[model samples]
Target: MKAPLLLHVFPGFAVGGAQVRFAMLANRMGPRWRHAIVSLNGRMECAERLAADVSWERVPFAAEGSLPQRLQRTRALLRTVRPDLLLTSNWGSIEWAMANAAPGGVPHIHMEDGFGPDEARGQKARRVWTRRLVLRRAETVLPSATLLEASRHLWRLPEARTHLIPNGLDLARFAPGGQGGDGLPVIGTVAALRAEKNIGRLLRACALLAGEGLGFRLLIVGEGEERAGLEALAGELGLAGRTRFAGHMPDPAAAYREMDVFALSSDTEQMPFSVMEAMASGLPVASTSVGDVRRMLPPEQERFLAPCDDVALAGALRPLLCDAALRRELGAANRLVAERDLDQDRMFSAHASLIERLLMSRAALAA
Candidate 1:
């Protein structure tokens, strides 16, 4: 029997959640599926995160130029790969749907993890119309309930072709460690220093706590375009020494273990992997109310504040930091939630099974 061929297309292979998820899926699926990744822009940073044994491709198409040139490049790449199935992600690669609309008609699957800062809380009609037209022939994969609704209601996609597949995490790698500081409280957040992540809010919140004479250190892990601005904000807020920006740690699990509390100040999200990883690391989280966060977190742990509100965020963080017993209880509950739903083995197996089923169904239709 021949192995199935799956080609994944993205805007760029950077260190984002979607890229990480794809790498994990490719590594875990192993020999059963042959994989190739094509990024519109030439950044292959996330490719390094893939398992050493997995064979993949990194095709870069220049994003600038006339529409004809762009479409021509996309069509050429599709013809070259001749994949059994073509999977494109988000708005950036939606153009691939048009490029792949040839006679043999390779099955197209488009995954929408979430939106960027430009369309954070709502849908853009122009983009939605384009999606409806370009994605009409493709099967849509929505990773969260919020996205599922967006596809069905906002984009008006057909129910038959839209499928919901929740994002999963690696439980074993993120498990809690007993080793950490026992002195002043520590609050931490792990994410790219992007504007949408709202790291500035976290800095301000920490500064407010510092003003109250509560000694706590805020550790931010990950790096991006907003690093310099965030660093400046910390200094401006008089949190220069109280906030530590750890730029792009190879393994964030150690940082999570060191944290007494976890924080997520994103202005937008849909089932963020960082929150799940923190919960798996057995830390209590105080995050903004965005996407399905209120639904994903346990009822007791659901202290969803408005995005970038330092006062509200400080109010939420105070209880978690000041009360040790509550922290232990919340952490234990979070661990249980992670074990029950976010185990990587289970996640990998679920994705493998879904892909197998998709292939089998396509074969039967062809027959």
Candidate 2:
């Protein structure tokens, strides 16, 4: 018998948290399932991470036309492909969810990562109603408690169908020990330079740290449309000398291994993979108190999670950069958490079990 086919729909297949997680899981699962990926916007940068042996193909589909036309097209394609399972990611792929929302539609799962800049502070009522209506029968996966609760009470998704599975990392691949170089401590971040990521906020915070005479190097590892604008902002903030924009790396393990402190200044996030990698690599994190970040770190390290403000973020980074002992202490605690809870094996098992169960149930129904 042929392996079951799993179709994954993404807003864009760029290298971000969602795409990277999909690539990791697909690589691990190997030939257990055939995979089809559709990048709504046609950006397939993250596909480079997939292993050569994985049974997967990218579906050449770009989202076009008005809502009704797009929905009709998606539903027609779903009928033609007749996948064993359909996995739609985030709000950007909601149309796919809507297209597959029929009573006997293919076994569907919707993954909610987080909101974009428009809905960063609060979710739009229109979207709330739409999700509540369309995602009623689908299995909903949320990576953070914040989103899980929102899915239950706010979106009013069925309790039984909703799942809270925290994102995980390969703890062994990221280990503690970046020899604190004599030149300057490296404060690093691995995130797509997007508006919602607010890399500019981080740059501004680092500028404040520099004004206070703190010596450190900023290493940004990722690529996006916002690069030129962010580089300009760095120059304006006088961070041109200290900051390095190391554009998209296939693997950011070395970047994490080189950092003394990790930073996240995004306006929104739900269990960002960068923080998990940093923790596994034993680097203390100073970040905006967004999504599940505060809960991800040890209690002692919560002080470093500041509000989304330049001065507050700077203050959070100050103590971590000033005292070497604190960094080591927090880094050790973070590594312990990663080992105990965030191992990729646990995530692989949970996701695989869920997918297999869904495929089996759908097959039984079909039979």
Candidate 3:
């Protein structure tokens, strides 16, 4: 018998949370399931990470035309592929959700990571209405408490249909890193330089630290549309030699190793994998208290998470940067959390079971 087919639709198949999660899941599951990926924006940044053995196809989407036209295109694509399971991610893939609303549609699910800059102010009325209309029939998966609650209330999804699957990581790949060379502590962040990520806020905070005669360097990892703007801001803030803009790294394991501290200055996020990765790498994190970040950190480390701003973020990073002993103490605590709760094997098992259960349900319905 043929293996179950899982079609995943993403706004863009970049090295973001949704894409990375799917890649890791596909690699772990091996030949148990076949995969189809659709990227609306047609960018597959993380495609290199997929296992060589996984049978998968990428259905290209040019993202042309108005709302109705896009929906029609998605529906036509669905009719063509006719996969056993349809998986969509975030608002970018909402049109696919709308496509699934048609009569005799394929069994579908949506995995929401978070919103883009468009919803930075609030969930717009059109989006909320669209989500309510299209998501009624699909099972939704949320990896963070923030997303789960948002799905329940904002999208008005029933609790039963929403699964709160907290994000996990490959802990051993990011096992507690040892001390780097005896140089100044490195303040680093692993985030796509995007507007929502607010990398500028981090740069401003770095300036604040510099003003106080604080001695440290900043490492900005990951690439995005906002890279130029961030670089310009860094120059304006007089953080020239103090910051290194490492465009994009396939493997962030080495980056994490060199960092003495991890910082997240995102104005919007649910469960950032970077923070969890930093934790697993035995780095103390000083970040904004967005999403489930406050809950994700150790109790002792909670004070380090402030609102996304120069002063708040600077205040958060101050203690970690100034005190080496504090970094190690909090870093150890963070490592324990990553190992105890966010193991990748545990997450892979959960997804495998979910797929099996969903496939079984589809079979029963077909009968």
> What's the TM-score of every candidate structure?
0.93, 0.98, 0.97
Predicted structure with the largest TM-score when compared to the true one? 2
Minimal lDDT window, size 10, model 2: 175-184
lDDT of 2 by residue, 318-351 (tens): 9988888888999999999889889888788888
Candidate 3: which pairs clash?
none
* lDDT by residue (tens digit), candidate 3, 126-216: 9888888888888898889988887888879878888888888888899876555599999999988778999999999999999999999
Tens digit per residue, CA lDDT, model 1, 248-306: 87667888988888999888888888988888999888988888777777888876345
Q: Candidate 1 vs candidate 2: which has greater TM-score?
A: 2
Candidate 1 similarity to native, TM-score = 0.93
All models: lDDT? 0.82, 0.92, 0.87
Candidate 2 ranges beyond 4 A from true positions: none
Which predicted model would earn the best lDDT?
Answer: 2
lDDT of 2: 0.92
